[model samples]
Target: MPLSDDALDQLFREARTHSAWLPKPVDDALLRQLFSLAAMGPTSANSSPGRFVFVKSAEAKAQLKPALSPGNVEKTMAAPVTVIVGMDMAFYDYLPKLFPHTDARSWFVGNDDLIRATAQRNSSLQGAYLIMAARSLGLDAGPMSGFDAAKVDETFFAGTTIKSNFLINLGYGDHAKLHARNPRLSFDEAARIA
Candidate 1:
């Protein structure tokens, strides 16, 4: 069955990209649940390359600070959690477990171009899933790309095969600080029938 109108409003129409957040903290359990929800989104060959880093501690935020562009710094730091969504370049290595049938891994093995493109695209889709998951859980999200990816990888992923994709701030938003919602393209203007 389709979701109710109220559910659609909660997940889409009424939801906004929030920058100013309430001082309320997000629970660890909720974050874990959020990931489980997001993980259900599909990826090619079940590559599921998205790796997230939840930066909440003062030290972690400080380490993330210099990487953020000037405009993104304050809001990101003030939020309860900042997720560094990274793509695991070696995601194909797990196809044996994730796909579990035939030789799905062979499709990407030794093909650096395919690996990079697929990892980037699927991880971004996962990041969008993360945003929806946050909203579904009564949290607001501010997904952004205004940061230095290399710096973020250095500070957060270090020795891992993961490479930073984007950042998303999550928490209870201070709606009082919200600006008027921006306009979006109407379906007729943005899409075409074949």
Candidate 2:
């Protein structure tokens, strides 16, 4: 369902990082809609490198359990779904079409360092887009990085060059789980004009 302006503001500005979730599942249809919306967000040269793996079932969730920090384990396990946000290291393979004007593929080829940096940076941006997209769709987000990356890679990305960048718990969040909103720096404190 498309949100109203008030709903959008509440979802984006007032939404909290919920550690607990109600027992509500995130269906594939919803995920499809989320990706459809989030994919429209810009990426450098249209690299669109983000990849998502929705861990929903017991078996799949088990693969992620060991990677989570103890503090995050219970909440993540309780959430209806957790999404592994990853990036394809070979994102440039599609660049001929994604950035047709230049030799974009050549920009990444043989440059492991460049590929790594670009994939991580772009994919993280896409992850943020995913969070906003979920909120727009009336879902809550708990973007987390408190996990063992190596363990996640072993369990989820085995046999693939995709690397796990972050995880997000998805569901109807329990508002009681939220902490108070923290303060933000003022414009003068955070920005500067040239």
Candidate 3:
């Protein structure tokens, strides 16, 4: 559906991170469309570092079970899908074309520190893009930081440079279960002009 101004406001302005979900499944085609939109969002050096692992099956969610905090386990497992947002530490390897006219790829290859930093920064940006993308596609999101990073790495990223950034549960949410919208800081409270 085309997003009207009111629709855009409804998607972001009033959106909540839903902890409870309806049983409706997010179809594969819609998931693909969501990603197709999200991947086009910008990243530094065009180093698209984000790699998503969509955990939909019972078997996959089982693998993710040990990584969750006790409080997060049931809600996450009950969702239709839990996305594993990851960052490729070697994301800059493709920067020859991604950020051409400079040796940006060389900038990260030698410095483990720089590579890690850029991967994390860019991947986090991608995760935000994922949230907006999901909202635009009419899916409710529950992004969570309550998980064991080490266990997630062991279960999902073993033998790879990809590291888990966070997890986001995706599905049709039950509006009846939503909490009242929480307060947000105003611009004066959050930002300052130098």
Top lDDT model: 1
Residue 23, model 3: lDDT of 95
Q: How far off is model 1, as Cα RMSD?
A: 0.7
Ordering by lDDT: 1, 2, 3
- Model 2 residue 17 lDDT? 82
Candidate 3 local lDDT, 53-144, one digit each (tens) = 99999999999999899999999998999999999988887788788889988778789898888889989989889888998889999999
How far does residue 22 in candidate 1 sit from its true spot (Å)?
A: 0.4
Q: Candidate 2's residue-wise lDDT over 1-194, tens digit each?
A: 88687986766668888888998888899999998998989999899889899899999999899999999999899999899999999999989998999998998899999899899999999999998889888889899999999899899989988999999999999987678888889999999999
By TM-score: ranked, best first: 1, 3, 2
Q: To one decimal, what is the Cα RMSD in angstroms of model 2 from the true structure? A: 2.4
Best by TM-score: 1
Clashes of 2: 0
lDDT-best of 1 and 3: 1
Q: Candidate 1, which ten residues in sequence have the lowest lDDT sum?
A: 101-110
What are the lDDT figures for the candidates, one per model?
0.95, 0.91, 0.90
The per-residue C-alpha lDDT of model 1 at residue 80 equals 98
Tens-digit lDDT track of model 1 for 102-171: 7989999899999999999999999999999999999999999999999998888889899999999999
